[model samples]
Target: MGRRPRQGPPRPPAAPADIQLASDPQPDLEHEQTVEAAAYYDVDLTNRLAERVEFFQCRFKKATLAGSHLAKVRFTDCLVETSDLSNLRAEKGTLERVKLSDCRMTGLAWSDGLISDATFTDCKIDLTNWRFARFDVVTFEDCNLSGADFTDADLRGASFTGCDLSGAQFHNAKMAGTRFRTCELEGVGGIANWEGAIVHPDDLLGLSYVLAGALGIVVRETDR
Candidate 1:
C-alpha cells in the first residue's frame, strides 16, 4: 500500500494573551535570553547580533529585524506580521508552530534551520537561503519565493500554494511528498530531483518546460 496521506493544514501558533505583554514593550534581545508571552511592535533590531535566543508565545508586528545575525535562535508558538526580516541571518535556527504573514524576508538566510508546523502567507521571500534546512508541516501561501535556494534541504512535509517560485534552486533537495499548487515553476533548477513531488495539473506546463530545458529538449509550435 502507498504511504499514508500527509496531514492537511498545519497547526497554527497559539494565541498570546494581551495581559502577558512584556513590562518593557521593546525589550532588548540578548544572547540566550528567553522571552515568552510578549508582544513587540515596530521595534527595530537592525544589524543586531545574538546567539541561541528564544521567543515563545510572542507576536511581532511591523518589527524590523533586517540585517540581524540571530544564529541558532528559536521561535515557538509565535505570530509575525508585516515584519521586515530582510537579509537576516538565522543559520541553524528553529521555528515551531509559527506563522508569518505579510513579512518582507528577501535575502533572509535560514540555512541549516529546522522549521516545523509553520505557515508563511503573502510574504516576500525572494532570494532567501534555505540550504540544508529541514521542514515539517510547513506551508507557504501566496508568497514570492523567486530565486530562493533550497539546496540539500528536506521538504517532504512542505507545501506551496499560489507562490511565485520562479528560478528557485532545489539542487540535492529531498522533496518526497512535497506539494506545489498554482506555483510558478519556470526556470526552476534541479528538475531531476523532483521525482516524488506532487504538483497541480495547472502547473505542469511550466514545470514541463523546465524539465525539457534540463533534458535538452526543444519544443516548437507547428502551423495548423
Candidate 2:
C-alpha cells in the first residue's frame, strides 16, 4: 500500500489556564510604575501609555493591553503569551528576539518600530496596523491577520506561513523578499502597491483576481 500523506505540522499546545482573562477590563497603567524584571501576569493595562521604558527579559503573560501606547521602548528577549492587545500602539520601539505566542492583538498598531528576529506564533492579529515600521527577518506562523494593514512599512525578509490575510492592506509598502506560504489573500487591498514585493507563484493565484479587476477583464470558469 502507498504511504498516506502526512498531516500538517502538529499544532502548538494551548496556553496555560491562568492565561485566560476572567473579565474584559481596561488595563491600568498607573499600576505599572516600575520597570523591574518581574512577571506581569493577569493584569489589565488598557488605555495606558508607557514611554521611554525598557523591559529586559520580562514576561507578560495573559495581560490585557487594549488601547495602550508604548513609545521609545525596548523589549529584549521577552516572552509575551496569551496577551490581549487590541487597539494597542507601539510606535518608535524596538523588540529584539522577542516571542509573542498565542496573543490576541486585533487592531493593534505598530508604526515606526523596529522588530528584528522576532517570532509571532499562533497569534490573532486581525486588522492590525504596521505602517512605517521596519521588520528584518521576522516570522509569522499560523497567525490570523485578516484585514491587517502594512502600509508604507519596510518588510524585508519577512515570512508568513499558514496565515489568513483576507482584506489586509499593504499600500505603499516596501516588501522586498517577502514570502507567504499557504495563506489566504481574499479581498486584500493595495494590489498595485508592489514596489518591490516578491511573492510565491502559488500565492499569485490570489493576485490574479485583483489584476483582473485592474485590467477591467471578467474571468469566467468553465465546467470541466
Candidate 3:
C-alpha cells in the first residue's frame, strides 16, 4: 500500500457506495454534511451553496461545478476526473488523498486551504487562487498552472513535474523540500524565495535573468 496523505484530523466514516448524488443544491446546508462513497457523471453543480460538507471517497466525472460556493469543506480520497471547476469558489477547505486528473480548474478560488497527498495531474489550473494555502506532499504533474497564485503559501514537500508554471506567483512561499522536475518556470515570480527548492540545471539556466534581477545584477551583452 502507498503512503497515506498528510491529514490534519480524522474524518467520520463514509456512507455506502450506493448513495445518490445531490441533484439540486441544498438551500441551507448545515454543519458537517457528508457526501461520500458516490459517483456522479455529467452532472451540473452550478451555483451551489455548500458549507462544512465532507466529500469522501466520491468520484465526479465530466461534471460542471461552475460558480459553486464551497467553504470549509473536506474532500478526502476523492477522484475528480474530466470535470469543469471553473469559477468555483472554495475557501479554507481541506483536500487530502484526492486525485484531480484531466480537469479544467480555471479561475478557481481555493485560497487558504490545506492540500496534502493530492495529485493534480493533466489539469488546467490556470489562474487558480491558492494564496496562503498549505500544501504538504502534493504533486502537480502534467498540469498547466499558469498565473496561479501561491503567494505567501506553504509549499514545503510539494512536487511539480512536467508542469507549465509560467507566470505563476510564488511570493514569500515556503520552498523547503519543494521539487521541480522537467517543469517550466518561465516568468515565474519571487525568484528570491526559491533558494531551498530543488530544480534541474537546465531549468536553472533558464532562470538566469530572473536570478540576476533578484540579486540586483545587470546582465548586459559584453562585446567580444
Candidate 4:
C-alpha cells in the first residue's frame, strides 16, 4: 500500500507592531567598545581596524561600514541583515556560518579572506572585488552582482542560484565544483578564464553568446 502525503507545519500569526516606526531613531554603535552577543543597529563605522573581533550570535541590522579594515575577524552564527558594506576591505578575515541577507555591498574587497558556510540572500554586490579569496560552501541566492569582479579567487563548492550576474567578471578564477543555477548572464564577461568551473548543463544556455564569441562564429537563425 502507498503512504499518505506528509503535511507541513502550521504558519505562525503575524505580529501587531509590524508597521510601527521608531520614535527616538535608534543610536548607531552604542556598544562599540563592548564585545558581546547583542544586536547592532543603524551604525556607521568607517576607517576602523577591527582585528580578531568575534561576533558570536550577534545581529547587525541596517548598519553601514565604509573604509573599514577587518583582519582575523570571525562572524560566527551572526546575522548581518540590510547592511551596507561598501568600500570595506577585509584581509585574512573569516566568516564562518554567517548569514548576510538583503545587504548592499558595492566596492567591497575581500582579498585573501576566508569564507566558509556563508549565505548571501537577496544581496546587491556591484563592483565588489574578491581577489585571491578562498570561499567554501558559500551560497548566493537571488543576488544582484552587476560589475562584480572575482579575479584569481578560489571558489570551491560555491553555489549561485537565481543570481543576476550581468557585467560580472571572473578572470583567472579557480572555480572547482562551482554551481551557477538559473543565473542571468547578460553582458557577463570573462568566461574564457574559468580554468575548472563546473557549471550546470541547464545554465549553459547563458553561455551561448560567450561560446560563439570565443570561436569567432556568428549564430544565425534559419526561418522555415
TM-scores of the models, in the given order?
0.93, 0.79, 0.86, 0.77
Regions of model 4 farther than 4 Å from truth: 1-34, 219-224
Off by over 4 Å in 3: 1-32
Q: Pick the candidate with the highest TM-score.
A: 1
User: Mind sharing the TM-score for model 2?
Assistant: 0.79
List, in order, the clash count of every candidate structure.
0, 4, 0, 0
> What is the TM-score (0 to 1) of candidate 4?
0.77
lDDT of 4 by residue, 139-161 (tens): 88999888888777776557788
Q: Which 10 consecutive residues of model 3 have the lowest summed lDDT? A: 1-10
Clashing pairs in 4: none
Q: How does model 1 fare in lDDT?
A: 0.91
lDDT of each residue in 204-224, candidate 1, tens digit only: 998989988998988789779
- Name the candidate, 2 or 4, with the larger TM-score value: 2
Residues 47-120, candidate 3: write the lDDT tens digits.
Answer: 77878888878878988877889898888888889999998888999888788889999999889999877788
Model 3 clashing residue pairs (backbone)? none
User: Largest lDDT belongs to which candidate?
Assistant: 1
lDDT of each structure?
Answer: 0.91, 0.74, 0.81, 0.71
